[model samples]
Target: MNSALGSRQAAAAVVLLFSYNGLVIGAYAASIPSLTARFGLAPWQLSTLFVCMGLAAIASMQVSGRLSDRIGARRVSLAMIPILVAAILTIGLAPSLPMLFVAGILLGLGNGGIDVAMNAIGVQVEQHRPKPIMSFFHGMWSVGNLAGASMLVLLAPLFAPDPQPAVATTTSVAAVLGVVAFVVAWRITPETAVVTHTDSSGTRTPIPASAYLLGLMAIGFGLGEGTANDWSGLHVTQIAGVDPTTGALGYTCVVGFMVVIRLLGDQLVARFGRRAVTVFGGACSGVGYLVTALGSGLPVLLVGWSLVGLGIGMIAPQVYAVAGHTAGGRGLAVVVTFGYATFLISPALIGSLVATLGIQKTMFVPALLLFGLVFAARIMPGREDDVAPSAEAEASWTEPA
Candidate 1:
């Protein structure tokens, strides 16, 4: 193991931190409507805000990756998580538009920093584990997402009528949880040796081809997820001729199955192997999206989305694990950046395509992307390749990023 804690203990802490990040993201998502109403944000403004957050997160990932490689992931995480917590609180309480924008940037930076640093830590811990555990860690992220959204849903009703009060209350609760998680994360950080590199010839190493290939896989998964986040509900609504509230249940099915698949992803990967599992997941998603785009009934839509969730859920953890193995923090950063970019661009890309091709046809885009995963998944590591590579292994990396 990497830090002061044993592998098992470190895995627990990593799970907690992953959940914490997910909670923040879920709370932020759940509060979006309220935030929109409170600020009277125009659609363009909302888009701009997301763009800013995404750009900042990208920058944060790059910086955090290099820093983690240089110093240590535990140290980087200690600094980043607190910033995320503070940013969350600031966002919840921002009094002006300018302040909200500033808070958004910090929120992105903090969240991104935590993502890179903690993932590095997770990779460190995974290196020493007896069996595959990355999926479980990532699964807890889904659990946190469910918990965060549920918190707002259950609590918001108590403060109903004004959206602001409900959002403020939820954010406050999330912040408290964030504080608790930050401490736990530190105490349980894994104790494996950190990966550090210095070129005696004064040359920087280029990222390997395998890492970039995995990044492309990340993009495929990212777009599939982003589509579900924004369009699944709307798509089902139009198809089933139902209200938004009823249509939302379709996407709920997606998320529910997503959480389930991720929770079980480890065993699946272990039994079927990573490459097999990924390719299977890709096929499932591709067929599921096709069913969704062509289906006319609510029941069918639900099944389609369930498949979509199940398939997409299997991807991220595997890719993250593979990327980490490929090049440690730098590779993880690359994959994370590629994956997260979908969140920012997928909506706009789909929306524009919807204008020309219609929503049903546009749904096929992600299906196509998901299908790409079938072949792209060849880059995933085999079960026997779980451990971090040695110096000799590092020297053999010649693939271009």
Candidate 2:
């Protein structure tokens, strides 16, 4: 065993930080309507505004991954804290859509930076542990979302007097949470950076093929996540005839269930191999979307979301773990950061799909994609093989991104 706290502590730190990030995102989502009303923007216009955040996140992931590898996760994480706090504050103080867009970009960049840095750290920590801990760490992100959403919902009354006032209040609270999380990250992360080294050539090495595969896998997983983020409410409203408040319940239930399952995922993955877990998880997710598409009423809708949560719980972490093991575990921070960037595209794609197809029917697309994931899981390499080149290596990977 690795001593007191060990890898688990590192994992917890990453998860907690991620949860704080989630809270900011949740508050932003909850406040979107207010933003639209305040600016008198159409749904499409609001979406366009939000796209800057996603794009910035994706770009930052790619840039930050390499930067973290060159510097260290500790520095990158510490530096990102102020950016996150600043971005949140900007959102609270924005006077125009353009200013909000700038804030969104900053927020996305900060979010991407934190995400990649944390995953890199989590990947490092998981390496020494007895269990597969990545899934659980990633799952904690869901827990953060739950906390964030709950906070927004609870604070709804604080802004009930006016849309702008409510949004400002929520944004202010989120900014404070971001600051607190930054302080926690700064305190826990060592000041002197821990650099991962390779034995050959006595020089730091770059991430290898598997790192890119993790990124591709992220693309698939992101698609699934995006589906939930963008469409769950649509299903509830259109199919279940629920009010927006009740429709929001669909996302809440799915995210809540996902968080719980992910929190316990390390134990589950330790008990069962990643391959088996992913296969079954993909099946469950497919079923969940199928249920959402065809099943009637709230009970079915909630079940669909729960199943989706359970299914996706382990997938993201598995990808992160694979990124860590590649290239003798060198450049892991970069791998995770870049791979995550690719995955962030899913939500926008889901939005486009929903626009093209009716929302309820579009929900089925995720199920179909998950069915593909079942096959993808089959092709995924085991933990050891993912790192070492072997005669048994079957999974194809792209050159380092």
Off by over 4 Å in 2: 1-9, 191-207, 241-249, 327-357, 383-401
Cα lDDT tens digits for candidate 1, 170-230: 8888889888887777676654345544355746677777788888998999999989988
lDDT of 2 by residue, 74-133 (tens): 567767777877887778679998888888888888888777777666655565456666
lDDT of candidate 2? 0.68
**lDDT by candidate, in order shown:** 0.81, 0.68
Best by lDDT: 1
State the lDDT at 56 in candidate 1. Answer: 98
Tell me each candidate's RMSD, in Å, in order.
Answer: 3.4, 4.9
Q: What TM-score fits each model?
A: 0.94, 0.83
